[model samples]
Each structure stands twice: as C-alpha cells, then as structure tokens.
Target chain A: MTIPVSITVNGRRYDREVEPRLLLVHFIRDVLGLTGTKVGCDTSQCGSCTILLDGVSAKACTCLAVQADGASVTTIEGLAGDSELHPLQESFWNKHGLQCGYCTPGMILASHELLRCNADPSAEEIRHGLEGNMCRCTGYQNIVRAVRDAAETMQGGTS
Target chain B: MFAPQFDYYRASSVAEAAALLEQHPDSKVLAGGHSLIPVLKLRLAAPSALIDIGRIDGIRGIREEAGRIVIGALTTHAEIAASATLQSGATALSEAAGMIGDPAVRNRGTIGGNVAHADPASDLPAVLRCLGAEFSIAGSSGTRTVDAADFFEGLMTTAVEEHEILTSISLPSGSGGQGSAYAKFSHPASRYAVIGAAASVAVADGVCSAASVALGGLVPAPVRAEAVEDALVGKALSAGAIADAARCVGDSLDDDEVLGDVYASAEYRSAVAHVWVGRALTAAAARCG
Candidate 1:
C-alpha cells in the first residue's frame, strides 16, 4: 500500500504517494530527480547518502520517505543558498578535494553541518566530524584542507 | 535495496501505537530507523505493518523529575550526548552516547530503538546497567516499569512485550561524591565495543564507599561486574587499587560465554576485558569529588 508523503526539498514543497519501503534517498533521487545525492553503500555504512533532515545531517539511505513525511530536507543541490558557490563547494574545487567525485556530494553536505555547528573547527575536529562519509581516493588530506579553508572563510578569514 | 512491502501508520500517541500493534498482529514499532531499516534492507524479518511512532512528541525529550533523570524513549543519541544534564549528572551515559557510531548515525538512532533491539554490542545497555536505570513500557492494559537488569532478557531480546512500547527510562540523578565513566576498545570497522566497561563510584574521605560496574560488548548481555564492585567497596581508589579491583572482573565471566568472531577472538576479548574495566574505573575515580 502507498501512503501520502509531503516533504520540503531545497525550498519547495513536493507532495506524493510513496510505498512504505521507499527509502528517503530514493525519494530524493528518483521521485524528485535530485540526483546529486548519490547512494554509496546503501547499508548506511558509507555516508554517501547523507542529507540534512530538519537541519540535522542523517543517513538518508537508512530512513524511509514516510519517516520524513512532515519534515524538510536539504541535499547537495540546495547547499549554496543564493550564492553562486558555497565556501565549501569552492574550496573543494580549488583544493582538488575530489578524485572520483562520487563521494564529494555527501562529503560536502556532511562538512556543511559540521561547519555550521562549529565555525572554527580544528583539523582533528573536521576529521572526526566527517568520519561517516568515506572517500576512496584523495586520502582525506586535501578534504581536510578544503574544510579548513571553508571554516576560515565562513568565520570571516581567520587564515 | 528496498524494504519489503508493509502497510504503514503514523501513530499520534503512545496509546495509539499500542492499539495499532494490537490491530496489526505482525506490526513493528518504527523509531529512529537506524536499527530497523538495516534489518529490513537485509530481509531478516518482514512484518505485515509498521506503526511509525516517530512523531509522538510527548516521548522525545530528556528531563529531570524530582531526583531522577527521565529520558523519553524517542530521545536520540545526539541529544543524549549533547545534554548538559547528562553531561554533568550522568557523565558515563553521555560519554557512551558520544562513542556510538559516527555523527550521522548518532543523529538518527534513538535510545528506545537501541534498547529494544537490544544488540549486545550496543553501548547504552551497559551504561544503563551501571546506572541502575529503569524502563517504562506501555501496553494496551496499562504502563509498567522494569529495572535495567530485568528489562534486558538476552541478545537482541528485551522484556518489552510484543504489544508494548517503551515510553521512557529513568535513573537517580548524579549524587554528591560520585562519578561514572564508560570505556571501550572499539572494533576499528564497526565501532561496536570489543569489550566495553562502565563504572560508577562513590568516594568519601579518600576511600571508596560504594561502586557499581557493568561490562558489555564481549558478553551476550550486559552483566554487572559484581566481583569488581566487591573488591572496591573499601579500597582507596588509587591507580593500583582500582587496577587490582578491576581485574576481579574476570571472576564475573565464564570463559565459555564470551562472544568471538573473525573480527575478535573470544580469548582476545577475555584478555582485554579487565584492561577496559580498569580504564573505566580509573577515569570514573578521577571524576569523583
């Protein structure tokens, strides 16, 4: 049986009927065509499906669309508000933070939540914050640098 | 991987959830979806229906009532980790909460789901055992409460009946001259404890007056380290004293009962059990006022 689900993605509200088995990641990618959110492990092990649910980073692969029926979702496509590029997005590009780029979307979204809570997170804090999202390539040194740059820029250039 | 077809209901209240369970015989309570979703994806167990109680707002906050700290079942691990009350009053619980899975997992996993699913390696059971927390379960008949020791029956099994839902868990607020801590050797991949230990101590005049200790992750269910507790009751709680008492934790385990697999052997887990127990005791004793 299908049930009615109303969710606000990015800034627009979309209402649809979904199966109880449909995962939130599928709803974001398949139903809404927000394909930027990639599914990595599908078991919630690899944080490739991370999204902000009601302003908190959660593994979309591990949650059902119905579970988030009345909530708001923010995916990678929505990260850069009105700006042409969010600081994290720009730093990732300049620092060459992506090798395969498959893990980049989840990495950026997860890092966004971490930087939101802490504007001046140290290297260790950034590493610990993004532990859920995994990158096969890059070895995380440049990812850490990109997040550090974004944090400095967000805090008005402490660098 | 998609979960199998199942009817869904978003319960408005605890009573409604219980009633839904009664109406739908094979229905399951869906909380944070951290545990259940993974199981469903694996096709381990498929229920006919799912009663989504995630929106029942009344069962989702942490509060202090009288002298006890009451945590609604819907309270998430992130909330518990960030709670000032838990951080100051029940430091061990907060520490364990922070050590659970990575940040995103902590954000969505609820205490009730973790407790009800009752994975032996999960951290909260051991902390609850150390703190002597009580669980409140609601059913069609009414609400009933059980002690932590009795609430957990076995691995992935609990005292919550099929028709019931856990509403909240409560424990005495931290007392004077008391401190508690949880320590674990995390399995590098899964992050589940290889051998977890929780210690709560009361010190007075440079001597240990009372102590409660529980061990998890290595055993089938969380067990109280009574032998360790007995050895510390009258000791000075010095580094050496704590080590000597913590070693007695061996007496509480049967060599044949420890869990082992390709990740960690039973012998290895038994050998390091006291190391974590000692670390927990040392840290807990340091926090004692």
Candidate 2:
C-alpha cells in the first residue's frame, strides 16, 4: 500500500505518494531527483546519507519517507543558495576535505549541526561531533581542517 | 537500503496507536526509527504495518512532576543530553544518552524506544536500571507504571505488551547530593558497549546511605548488581569497599550465561565488568556532595 506524504525539501514543497517502506534517502534521490546525498553504508553506521530533518541532523537512510511527512528537510543541494556555496562547502573545497567526494554532502550537513551547537568547537570536539560521518578517502585530517575553517568563516572569520 | 513493504499509520494519540496495534497484529510502533527502521531495512523484522508514534503530541518533552523528573517517551537522546535537569539530577542517564551511536543517532534515538527495544548492549538501559527509573505504559485497558527491574525482561524483550505503548519514564528528583555515573567498555567500531556499568550512590556522612548498581553488555540483558549494591550500602564508599563490591558484580551469572563474541570473550567481559563497575561507582562517589 502507498502512503501520502508531503515534505518540504530544500525550501520547496512536494506532495507525493510514497511507499511506507521508502527510505527518506530514496525519497530525496529517486522521487525528488536530488542526488547529492550519497548512500555509503545502507546500515545506520555510515553517515553518508545524513540530512537536516527540521534543522536537526538525522540519518536519511534509516528514516522512512512517511516519517518525514510534513517535515522540513535540508539536503546537500539545499546548502547552496542561488549563486553562493555554503561556507561549509566552500571550506571543504578550499581545505581539500574531499577526494572521492561521495561523503561530502553528509559530512557538510553533519558538520552544519556541529557548528550550530558549538560555534567555536575545539578540534577534539569537532572530531567527536563528526563521528557519524566517515570519509575513507581524506583520512579526516583535511576534513577536520575544513570543518575548522568553516567554523571560523561561519563565526564571522575572526580567526 | 529500503524497508520492506508495509502500511504506515501516523498515530495522533496513545489510544489510536493501541487501536492500530489491535487492528494490525503484526504492526510495529515506530518512535525514533533509529532502531526500528534499521531493523526493517535489514529484514530482521517485517511488520505488516507501522504505527508511527513520532508525532504523537503528549509524549515528547521532559518535565518535573510530583517530586520526579518525568520524561515523555519520545524525548530524543539529543534532548536528554542537552537537558540541564538531566545533567544535574540524572547524570548517568544523560551521559549514557550522549554516548549512543553518534550525533545524528542521538538526535533521533529516544529513551523510551531504547528501553522498549531493550538491545542487550544498549547503554541507556544499564543507566536506567541504576537510576531505578519507572516506565509508564499505555494500553487499551489503561495506563500502568512498571519499575525498571521489571521492565527489561530479556534480550530484545520488554514488559510492554504487543498492544501497549511506553508513554514516559519517571525518575526521582532531589538527587543533588546523590552521585551517578555510567562507565562502559565499548566496541571501537559499532560503539555498542562491550560491557557497561552504571552506579548511583547517595552518600551521607561519607557513608553510602543508598546504592544501586547495574551492568549491561556482558549478559543477555541488563542486570542489577545486587551483591554490589548490598556490599556498598552502609559502607564508607572508600576504595577498599568499592573494590570488594566490584568483585561481586558477575557473581550471580555463570561464565556461559554471559555473552561472548570475537569483540570480547565471555571470560574477558566478566573480568572487565568488575573494573567498569568499580570505576562507575568511584565516579559516582566523587560526584556526591
């Protein structure tokens, strides 16, 4: 049976009939055609499909589409406004945070929540906060650097 | 990964959820989806219907009620970690909640769901066991409260009946002078506790007036360290007293009864559990003011 779900994705609303078993990641990629959120590990362990569910970071792969009905979702595609890349995306590019770039969207969104909670997090705190997002390519030193740089930029670049 | 085909129903209230469960015998209650959806995708469970209780209004916040801190069933681990009341009154629970999977997992996992899932290796159950928390369960008949001891029955089993929903959990307040801590030896990858211990102590005049000790991840279910609790009460809570109590942690269980895997052997878990229990107790005692 199909369930009717209305979700606001990247600030746009789309009402669709989704299977109850349709994961939010599939709903975003297949239904909405926003492919930036990668599915690294289908299991909950990998943070590759992370998204902001109502401004909070959550694993999209584990969340059913119906569970997000009427909820506001922010995907990697949503991070960039018309012409400007998000500070996190820009930092990832500038700081060499991505090699495969598969984990970039999830990393950026997860880091988005981390910086939101702790604007000026220490390196240890940043590592702890991004424990959910894993990148096999960058070895995380550069990813850590990118998040640190983004924190500085987001904090008005005093550092 | 996609969950197997199932019909979904968003339960607006507890009664509706119970009714849906009655209407669909193989229905699963979806709270946070941190545990349930993963189970669904793995096909470990294929419930025909999902009663989504994530949006249920009455079961969502933490508040003080009648000398106790009553936490709604849907209160997320993130909320628990951030709650000042929990940090001060129930430090063990808050810390355990913080240590679950990671940041995204914490934002979605709920204490009620965790307790209801009753994963043998979950951190919150051990802490809840130590805190002597009570679970409020709602069913078609009515609502009833079950003590933590009676709540977790066995591996992935809970006192919550098929048609019932755990609505909230209640913990005693006035724990300012009491100290509580949770210490765990977690698997490096999954981060699930290999062996975890939680202890709560009320120290009066440097003596342990009241104490509760519980252990998880070493056995089929979270178990109260009755011997440890008995050994600590009325004692000075000194290093020697704690060491003596720690030794008794796994005395109640046989070696074979404890869970063993490549991550840790049953013998190793039994041996290390005492150390964690001791550490948790010491931390709790140090927090007592």
Candidate 3:
C-alpha cells in the first residue's frame, strides 16, 4: 500500500505517493535524489542518515516516510545557501574536521542541531550531543574542534 | 533494509485508534516509529496494518494532576529529558531518559514506545518501576491503570493487550523528597544498558524510611530488587548500610533468569548489578535534601 505524503524538505515542499514501507532516508536519498545525507549504517546505530525532522535531530533511517508526512525536514544539503557555506560547513572546512568525509555531512547537521539547542556548549556537551553520529576515520578530535569552532563562529566570534 | 508493506491508517483520536486496532487484529500502533520502524525494517514484525497515533492530542504532554505527575505516553525522550517538572520531581526518570541512545534517538523515541517495547536493555522501565509509576491504558472496553510492576510480563512482552494503547504514565507528586538516580553500564556500541540499577530512597531524619530498587539488563524483564529494598529500609542512610543493601541487589533472581551473552556473562551482569545499585542508592540518598 502507498500513502500520499507532503513533506517540506529544506525550504521546498515535495509531495509524493510513497509506499508505506519506504523509509525516510530512502525517500530522501533514493526517490528525492538528495544524496548529501549518506547512509552509513542501515541499522539505527549510525547517525550518518541523521536529519532534522521538524527542526529536531532524528535518525532518518529509523523513520518511515509515512511517519514524516506533513513534517518539515532539513538534510545536510540544506545547510548551505546558494553561494556561501553554512557556518558549520565553513568551520569544518577550516578546521579539517573530516578524514574520510563519509561522516562529515551527518556530523555537520548533528552539530547544527546541537548548536541550535545549546549555542555555547562545553566540549563534553558537544561530544555528548554528537554521540549519535559516529566518525570512524577522523578519531573525533578534529570533529570536536570543528564543532567548537562552529559554535564560536555561529555566536559571532572568529575561530 | 526496508520496512515490509502494510496498510497505514492515521487515527485522529484514541477511540479511532482502538477501533482501527479492533478492526485489524494484526495491526501495530506506530508512535515515533523509532522502535517499530527498526523492527519492521528488520522484518521481525510485519503487522498487516499500522495505526499511526503519533499526532494524538491528549497523549503528548507532561502535567500535574491530582497530586500526581502524569506524563502522556507519546511524550518523547527529548521532551522528558527537557521537562523541568520531571527533572525536579522525577530526576531518576529524567536522567534515565537522557541516557537512552543519543540526541537523535531521544528526539524520535517515545516513552510509551519504549515501555511498550519492553526491551530488557531499555533504561526507562527500571526507573519507572523504582518510581512506583502506574500506566493508564486505553482499549476498546475502557481505560484501565496498571502498576509498573505488573505491566512487564517477559522478554519484549508487556501487560498491554494487542488492542490497548498505553495512554499515560502517572507518578506520585512528592517524588522529589524521595531522591532517586539511575546508574547504568551500557554496551558502548548500541548504548543499550548492559545492567542498569534505578534507586529511590525516602529519607526521614537521616534514616532511610523507604527504599526501592529496580534492575534492567540482568534479566529478561525489569525486576525490582526487593531484597535490596528490604535491607535498606529503616536503616541509617550511611555508606555501611548502603553497602550492605547493595549486596542484595539481584540476590533474589535465579541463575537462569540472569541472561548471559557475548557482551556480558550472567555472572558479570549479576556482580555489576550490586555495584551499580550501590552507586545509584548512594547518589539518590545524597540528593534527598
């Protein structure tokens, strides 16, 4: 059975008839062709498929398209504007936050949600916030530095 | 992995949900879809239909009523962790909620779904049992309440019948005076509790007047540490007394009930249950001010 769903992705609204079984991650990656949000572990453990569901960080792989119906979702692709990079992206780039880059998009989006909730989080809090998103290659030091730098940049300070 | 195909029904109200469940006996109620979706994707549970009750109105808030703190079933872990009222009155529950998975999982996982899922490794059930909470269930017949002790049946089983929906969980309002804490040793990878101990102690004039301890991950379901509770009550809230009580944390359980796996042997889980209960009780007692 297919369910009709209208979801606003990033800023644009996309209405589609999705099978009841189609996961939100697949809907965004396969159907919508927004591949910025990588699927790391298809299981719920890895947060590479993390996205902002209605402005809250959630695992897209664990959510169904039907469950996200009428909801607003923000993915890694939504972080940047037309020309400029989002503060998180810029800070990550400046700080060399990624090694393999597979976990960068998810790390950036997860950090975005973290900074939104807590604009000035301590190192421990940032680590706690990004617990869901795993980076196998970066060893997390640079990612933590990137998040700290992003927090500083987002708060009107230079890193 | 993708979820198996199933008919989806969005119920506008609890009655509608119950009716839908009645009509489709093989239907599963989808709340946040954090737990259900994963199971569905694994093809472990392929219900014929899904009754989506994620947007139900009355089952989604934290409020005080009749000297009891009532948390709607649909309240997500994020909501519970962020609830100031819960933090003040039910600190153990709030702390436990915060410890489940991570921010992303907490944002999407609901208390009702967690309690109903009854995963032995889940953190909330043990904390709820320690808090002496009660569940308000909605079914076709009528609404009924069940104590947390009776609500859990066995591995991934709950007292909630197939047709019933867990509407809300209520705890006594004066839970703050009875300070509580949840000490958990979880698996590093999945963050599921390897052994968690939730402790609550009502201190009167530096004496432990009442005590309750519940354990998860050491058994098939969350079990109350009755022996630990018995050892602590009416004793001085001292390190010695707590140490004595901690020894009885899981003493009542049979060896077969203490599960063993590659992560933790039954003996290891049993031993840590004592240590964790001790730490949780010490922390809880220290907060009783």
Q: Give the per-residue lDDT of model 2 (tens digit) for B127-234.
A: 888898999999999999999989989999999999999999999974656999999898998999999899999988878999999999987778889888998899
What are the clash counts of all predictions, listed in order? 0, 0, 0
TM-score of each model's B chain?
0.98, 0.97, 0.98
How close to the true structure is residue B49 of candidate 3, measured as C-alpha lDDT? Answer: 96
lDDT of 2: 0.90
What fraction of the true Cα-Cα contacts (under 8 Å, chains A to B) does candidate 3 also have? Answer: 0.94
For each candidate in turn, the TM-score is 0.98, 0.98, 0.98
Regions of model 1 farther than 4 Å from truth: none
Which pairs of residues clash in candidate 1, taking residues 3 or more apart in a chain or in different chains?
none
Per-prediction interface RMSD in Å: 0.8, 1.0, 0.9
Whole-model lDDT, candidate 1?
0.93
Write model 1 residue lDDT over B240-267, tens digit each, in one string. 9888998898899988889998989989
| lDDT, candidate 2, A6-123, per-residue tens | 9999999999998889889999999999999888898777799999999999999888888899999999989998999999999999999999899889999999999989999989
- The complex in candidate 3 yields a DockQ of 0.88
All models: lDDT?
A: 0.93, 0.90, 0.90
